[model samples]
Target: MSVAVIGMIAGMALGFAGYFGGFGAFLLVAALGAVGFVVGRFLEGDLDPGEFFRPRDDRRR
Candidate 1:
């Protein structure tokens, strides 16, 4: 699925695990997921739009 959905699921899993086992593991995984989401979004924004749609070379009126 989408990166956001994956991030939420991972965060929930880590949060629950932390609740049951320890705090450090949970924080670590949750932080990782959050950072992944942020970085993924940032990189996605930098992609070339031409990859999605062909460029229009015509410039005449």
Candidate 2:
């Protein structure tokens, strides 16, 4: 249930995907995992959509 354990399992699955389906599969799986992690964080309220898209203030202006 921990993040590290989830990541390890994902890594292992992607490794198998690469072995059977080649580099393209590996990249696809990795991309999917990245997207899933982001979505999960957002849904869990660990990530804020506003903060992600907020503009930075120029202190010198």
Candidate 3:
């Protein structure tokens, strides 16, 4: 879902910059969605969102 949103946004940006029509934007979004999903799955092991934004938990009992 997130990937789809990102692709759509990116496609729109590209369309605006390069004057691509609706069909071009849709194609760009589809291509990006395919590539992004494949790459994300391959690199999933190397990513951790919590480590980037969440604070560490320290507790002693």
Compare the candidates by TM-score and give the number of the best one: 2
Alpha-carbon runs more than 4 Å astray in model 1: 2-8, 15-21, 46-61
Candidate 1 lDDT, 1-61, residue by residue in tens:
8969876788679878798869887778778777875677668896554555654765555
Each candidate's TM vs. the true structure?
0.48, 0.81, 0.39
If ranked by lDDT, best first, what sequence of candidates would result?
Answer: 2, 1, 3
Clashing pairs in 1: none
Candidate order by decreasing TM-score: 2, 1, 3
RMSD of each: 9.0, 2.1, 9.7
- Which ranges in model 3 have alpha carbons more than 4 Å from their true place? 1-21, 45-61
Model 2: residue 49 alpha-carbon error in angstroms: 0.7
lDDT of 2: 0.91
Clash total of candidate 1: 0
Model 2 per-residue lDDT tens digits across residues 1-61: 8989998899898999899999999999999989998999999999998887666873554
The list of candidate 2 runs beyond 4 A from truth reads 56-61
Residue 5 deviation, candidate 3, in Å?
Answer: 10
